[model samples]
Target: MRYFFLLVLLGGLGWCPAQAQAPAARHTFALGPTDFLLDGKPLQMISGELHYPRIPREAWRARLKMAKAMGLNTIGTYVFWNVHEPQPGQYDFTGNNDVAAFVRMAQQEGLWVILRPSPYVCAEWEFGGYPYWLQNVPGLKVRSQEPQYVAAYKRYIEAVGKQLAPLQVGHGGPVLMVQVENEYGSYGSDKQYLALNKKLFEDAGFDGVLYTCDPVADVAKGHLPGLLPAVNGTDKPAEIRRLVRANHDGQGPYYVAEWYPAWFDWWGAPHHTVPAARYTPGLDSVLRAGMSINMYMFHGGTTRAFLNGANYKGDTSHYEPQVSSYDYDAPLDEAGNPTAKFRAFRAVIAKYRPAGAAPLPPVPAAKPSAALPALQLTQYASLLGHLPAPVASPTPLTFEQLKQAYGFVLYRATVPGGRSEVLKINDLRDYAVVLVNGRRVGTLDRRLRQDSLRLALPAGPVQLDILVENLGRINFGAYLLQNNKGITRRVLLGGREVTGWRMYGLPFAQAPTVAAGSPTPAAASGPVLRAATFTLAQPIDTYLDMRQWGKGVVWLNGHNLGRYWAIGPQQTLYVPAEWLRKGTNDIKVLELLRPEQTALRFLDHPILSELSGPQP
Candidate 1:
C-alpha cells in the first residue's frame, strides 16, 4: 500500500515505471483462437473510456476513483492530438490536457489501460479530432491513405509514440491495448488504410495488443489481420461471438470495445437517455456469459469551450454540432457523480460476485453552491471596430499566418478587377456567407466542399463576411493531422484569389476581446442590479438553467461555473449541490447578444433541459 503512494508521488513528477517490478515477456500478447487470455489466464474486462481533456485536472483522481468503485477494472482513455500538439512541434502536457498523468492515475488505481490514440477520434469532439493546422497542406485527402495525409500522420504518431510506448505494460506500465484507427469501416472500405494503421502501430514499437472497433454491421471491414476484432456496441453477446467467429473461425469470448452506457446529444436532437433498468439486464447477460465489455464512457465529461463537435450523416454539409457538455446521459456525469444507472450496474456486478466481496460507497453529497447577483458586463466591443492591420502580401495567408485562435475570422477585401456578379472562396471550410454593404449576397458551406458564391457588387465599397468557426479538431485518423482551421488559402472574387484580409480573433470565450476598444454598454431597459443583493438561508440542491439567455458566462459565489450558450440542447447549466454554501449565497451571470430582461430558471434533471420535443 505504501508502494502505491510512492508510485503516485513519482508519477506526479512524470515517472514511467521502468524497473524489475514485473519483467515483461518478450512475446506480445495476441488474441488466440480460444477463450480470451491475459498472461494465459482467462480475463474479463470492465473498461471505461474517459477523454483526458474533458475533465479538469483537479477532478481526474476523484473521477477515476468513481469508475473503480463502479467495478471497472480497465479504464479506456483517448489521447487528443490537438491538445498534445497544439502547434506543429509545440506540445503542452500540463493541466487537464495531461494524458500521461491521467493514464498513470488510472493505473495506480489498479486498472488496465486501453489507450485510444486516434488522430481522428470522432467523439463529437471538435472537427472529429484532427489538429487545426492540418488544413494548410496543399492537396490533402483525409481518411484515405493519401501520401500528404500519411506524412503528417506519421510525424504526429512518431511524436506521440515516444510518450506512450515507454508506458506500455512491457515497460512496467499498465497500457494493455492500443486501438488502431477508430471505426474505419463506417468511413470507407479502405483495407489498405487499415493495414497501414496496423503496420504503423508495430513500427511505432507498441508491443501491447492492437485492435479496431466498428459498429456490428461493419465488423469485417473494421478487423485487421493479426489483431483482435471488437464490435462498438453489442447488447447481444451472441452477435459478438458470431463476429469473432466470422473473423477467426468461431473463436470464443467476443469483445465489445464500446458498449454504450448512454448516448450523445446534439443541439436540435432529442435528449437520449438509456434507463438504468433497461441497460442492466443485457449487461448482466454479457457478464454471466463470460464475455468482456468496455463502457464507451463510464463518466461523460464536458467538452467545455468551442471544442464541441457536430454530427454529419451525409456527404454535403448537413451538420448537427454538439453542445459543450458531453454528459452523454452517462452513469457518471461530467462532474463524476454516479447516477441511478451506476448503482444498477453495481448491483449487477454484486450479483455475480461472492457475498461481501465488494461493498458500494455511499452517494456523495452534491458540492455546495452560492448564488451571486446577476453579473453586469459594462464594456462592449464590436469585433469590426478592432481589426488587426491587414496582411498586405498578394500571396494569401493560412489561419496560422493570421496568428489567430478560434472563432469567426472575417476577411473583407475590395475588388480591384472586374465587377463580375460572382465571388467564391477557393476553399470555404464549414460555413461562410458573402455580404455586400451589410446585405446578404451569397452563402457557402465547407461540409458541401463549397466556398463558391455569386456576388452582386455595384461598383463602390464592397464587404465580404467569411465567418468560419474552428469546429474543434477532428479527434480520430490521418485526417486528424491535417486539421488546419479557417479558410487555409484565399477567397476568390470574380474567380480571382483575393488576398489582403483583415483578420479578427474572436475566441468568444476570451472576452473583452479585440473591440474598437472597451466602450460603455448601451443602457439596459429595466433593473440592472447596481449593488445587487441576495440571500440563501439554507443550502439547497438545484439545476441552474442557463439556456433562455444568449451567450455568456456564469458564476456562483465568485466560483466561475464556466461559459454557457443559448444554443439548443444545452439550455441549462448544472450547479452542483456540493459547490453551494448554507448562508446568503450569490449568483452572477454575464450575458452577451441577449435582450436586457433575460430569465434564469432552476430546472430538474442534471443536464440543461429535459427534452419535451423541439423548442418552440
Candidate 2:
C-alpha cells in the first residue's frame, strides 16, 4: 500500500505505467471481402449524415454527442465547396464552415467520420455547392470532362486535401473514407469523368478506401470498375442489396451511404415526415442482413441565408425553393432533441450490436429557447433609394454575366416609342417585380409560369424597372446548367425591344447600413428597406415572424437570417441569441413588396409546415 501510494505520487510527478508498457499496435481500416475490417477484424458502420455549415459552430460538439447517444459510431458530412471558396482564389474555413474542426469534434466524441467532399455536392445547397465563380469562367462545363471544369476541380480538391489529408485514419485521425462525386450515375453515366474524380482524390492524398453512392436504379451506371458502389434509398433493403451486389459482380459487403429516414421540405410544400415505424423495421432488416447503413440526416439543420437551393425540372416545371428549416424528421430534430425516431433507431441498433462494443452513450439535454414580444419596425429606406452607380449594358445580362452570385438585381431602361401593350421578359429566372416610374405594377413568378405582364405605358418616355430575385439555384438534375439568375434575354414591349439600360446588382453581400443618401419612406410602393431597434433585458433565441411582409431577406445584428415570403410554408426567420444583445438589437428587412403597415413580430416557434399551396 505504501509502494502503491508512492507509485501514484510518482505518476502525478511525470512518472507513469505508460512509459513502462509496450507501445500499442497501429490499427488499419480497410475494405474486406465481406465487411469493413479494422486491423483485420470485422467492423460495422452505423453512420448519420449532417453538414457542418448547417448547424451553429458552438453546437457542433452537442450534436455529435447526440449522434453518439443514438448508437451512431460514425458521422457523415459533405464539405461544401462554395462555403469554403466563396471567391475564386480567396478561401475561408473559419467559423461555422470549419469542417476540420467539425470532424475533430466528432472524433473527440468517440465517433468516426465519412467525408463527402464533392466539389459539386448536390445536398440542396446553393448551386449544389459549386462556387458561383465557376459560372464566370469562360467555356467551363461543370460535372463533365471539360478542361476548365476539371482544372478548377483539381485546385479545389488540392486545397481541401491540404486541410484534411493529414486527418485520415492512417494519420491517427477519425476520417474513415472519402466519397467521390456524389451519386454521379443519377446525373450522368460518363465513366471517364468518374475515373477522373477517383484520380483527383488519389492525387489529393486521400489514400483510404473511396466509394461512389447512388440510388439503386442508378448504381449500375454510376459504379466504377475498381471503386466500391454504395446504395441510397429507404425501402426494400433486400432488393437494394441485390442491385448493389449485381453492380459489383455479386460482392458481399454492401453499404448504403444515404438511407433517407425522411425527406426535405421546399417552400409552399408541406413539411416532410416519415413515421418511425415505417423505417425502424427497414433499418433493422438492413442491419440483420449484415449491410452497413448511414442515415441521410440523423439531424437536419437549418439552411440559413440565401444558401438554400431550388429545383426546376424543365420549361413546364414548377420552380420550388427549399425552406429555411431543414428539420428532416430524423432521429434528432433540428433543435437537437431526440424524437421517437431516435428511440426507435436506438432499439434497432442495440439488437444489432457487434460481439463486444461499448454501450450507447446517454442522450444530451435539449437546448432551451425563448419567445420574445414583437418589436415594431418604424425607420424605413427604399431599395430604389439605395442604388449604386449602375452597370451599362445593351442587352439584359444574367446574374453570372453581372459577376453577382445571389440575391436581387435591378434592371432599368427607357421604353422606346412608349406604348401600353404587353411587356414580356424573356426567361426571367425565378421571380420579378415590375415597376414603371418607380411604382409597383405587377409581379411575374416562375412558380406560376408567368413571364409577361400588361404594362400601361405613359405617352412619350417612361422609365422601366424590373427587380429580379434569384430565389435559388437548382441543386439537382440537368437544370443546374441553367441556374443563372436575373433577366436572361432582352425585354420586349408591344413588339418593340427596350434598349440602353443600367443594371444595379444587389448581392447584399454585406449587412444593411441605412442605404446611402435616401429619403425616409412615407408610402410603400416599391422594394424598401425596413429597420427597427428592439431592447432585450436578456438575450434569447427567437424566430422573427415574417407573415406580414412579402418576399424579402432579413438581417439581425449583421447576421443574415435568410429569405422570407408571404408564400405560407416558412413564415418565420430563425434568429439565434448569439446575434442579439442585452440592451439593444438591430433588425433590417428588404421587402420586395413594401407593406402599408410596417412592423416586425417574434414567434416562439418556426412556421415551417403551414402550407397554403398545392400539396407536393
Candidate 3:
C-alpha cells in the first residue's frame, strides 16, 4: 500500500492535496438570522450534485466548465462506497472513479466541492451502491449499527477518506463541506450511526463543515449534534419552511440536497420531465431568495454497466433499469449542451454573482452536425459456443454458484422427459428468456418481479436455457453497488429449485465474430448480440434509444453502457462524445429477452419518455 501523508490547506481555505496544495484561509462563514456570510462576507451557495463515476473521465472538465458557466458555485458529488472499496482493502482510486482528481478539478475550475460520501447514497443507484459481495458477509445487515457491517463500512470510510480528507479546505483543496451517509433519516432513525459517521469523518482529517441531509420526515432521527443539518426533499418556500421546522425549527441556510428537475422511472413507469420553463424559474426564486441549494444532478450522466437502480414500492421489486444515459433533463441536457434550462439558469445567476467576480463566461459556441463512415466489426463468439464445465446436482444456481464474474451468465439444463408446462424462473435477475427445443418461448424480468409465466415446449430430449445479464449493480444507498450475475439462487418449475444444471459463461460474446451475416438481427430467443453501424464525422455527445429494444445491454465499440429495458421511463442510453471515435463506429445491443435486432438511432438527449401503456 502506498502511504499518503496528510496534506493541509495552509491557511484553511483550500485542500491539502498530496502534491503541494493550497488551503482555505480561516474565516467566520456567517449565516446570521437574516444574512449569510463567507469569510465574513455574505455566503450564498448554488450547488449541483454529479457523480464522478457516472460520466466519462475525459468529459469531467467539460461538465464542470458547463456548471461554472451556468454560475454554480459548488459541485456536489457522491463518493460511492462500493466503487471505492469494490472488494475489501482493494481500493480503486483511478479513472472515472478518481474522486480525488474530480475534487481537484473542481477546485482548479474555481468551484467549491461538496463531497457526499455515502455508504448509503440513494441516487437511484443499484442496491443503493452496496457491493453484492457484502450480501454474503455472514450476518451483515446494511445501514445498521451492526459491528460487522460497521467494520466493513468503516473500512470503506477509511479507504475513501484516505483519498479525500486531504482534499478538504483544510488541506488546501476546494471541498467546502462533507455530507455524511446520505439520507439517513429516511432509511432509519439511528442517530448514533450519524454520530459515528461524524467521528469517522473527523478522524479522517476532514476539518471542513460536516452535515447530514434527508427529507424533512427524517430530521428527528438523522440530525447530528453541533453539525449543520440540511434537508433534501423540498424546493418550495412552504416545503422548505416545513422541513426546517421539522428539524431544528431554526434555519439560516437550508441545502436543497436534491432539487429534482425531473423524476426516475422503473421499467414500466411513464417518462417524466419537470419542464424547464416551470422549474427553472422556481429554482431562480429560491436563489433570488438567497437559499443554499444543490441539484441532485446538474449533469445527470450515465449509470453505465450494472450500476442502474431499482425500487421496492411496498413488497414488489421493480428495477428502474436506468438507461446508459442518465440525462435527468437538468439545466444541461445529456449531450452536454445548454438547454433552455441552462439559458434560464444563466440569466438567474447573472443577478446574484459576487460583485468582484466576473460575469459567467459567454456560453461556448455550439458544434454543428458532423458525419462519418461506417466501420464493420469482424470478430465475435456466441454464448453457446463456450460452456463452463458442468457443476454438481444440476439444480439452479445464482451468480454466486458459478463464481463467475459479472456481465452475462448462462444456465443450461435438460428437461427430464422434455418440456413441462407453467415453466418458470423463480427469480430472474432482471431479464431472461426460457428456451425449449432450441427455441425461445418466454422471457421474465425481475424488474416486473414476475414468476409463473406460461411457455410452450417440445417433445423428447429438450434443452432449457436461461441467459441472464447483470444490469449495472445498484450504485447508491444501503446496497450501494450490487454486482455478480446468474440466478444467484435457483430456477423453479412449480416452486422447486430446478436441478441438473449446466452453465456457460457469456463474457466473451461481446464484439462477437460476425460469421457471415450483417450482425443487425437478433439470433433466435436465447441471448443475442445485435450490432449496428453509424458514422461520425466530428464526434458529438448523444443518447441511444433503448426503448425500441427489449431488456438487455448496449456497447459502443466494446465499452459497456450499462443495462436497458423496454419498460418505460428511461428510453435513451447516453453515448458520450468522449467514447466516440472519428469515422465508422460500431454499436452492439444485447437483448436478453429473445434475440431480435431492434433498429436503434440517436435520441439526441436523455429525458424520461412516456410509457406506451397505462399502469396496471
Local accuracy by lDDT, each model: 0.66, 0.84, 0.68
In order of appearance, the predictions have TM-scores of: 0.77, 0.92, 0.85
Candidate 3 lDDT (Cα, whole model)? 0.68
lDDT of 3 at 90: 73
Which prediction has the highest lDDT against the true structure?
Answer: 2
- Count of backbone clashes for each model? 42, 0, 66
Residue by residue across 200-300, what tens digits does model 2's lDDT show?
Answer: 99999999888888987798888887788888884466786687678776765678899999989787777787899988888988888777899988988
Worst 10 residues of 3 by lDDT: 369-378
lDDT comparing candidate 2 with the true structure: 0.84
Considering summed lDDT, which 10 consecutive residues are worst modelled in model 2?
514-523
Can you give the lDDT of residue 424 in candidate 3? 64
Where does model 3 exceed 4 Å of error? 1-37, 237-251, 316-319, 367-380, 388-394, 400-406, 418-420, 471-490, 494-497, 505-525, 530-537, 542-549, 567-571, 583-586, 593-616
**Measured by C-alpha RMSD in angstroms, how accurate is candidate 3?**
5.9
Q: Is 1 or 3 the stronger prediction by lDDT?
A: 3
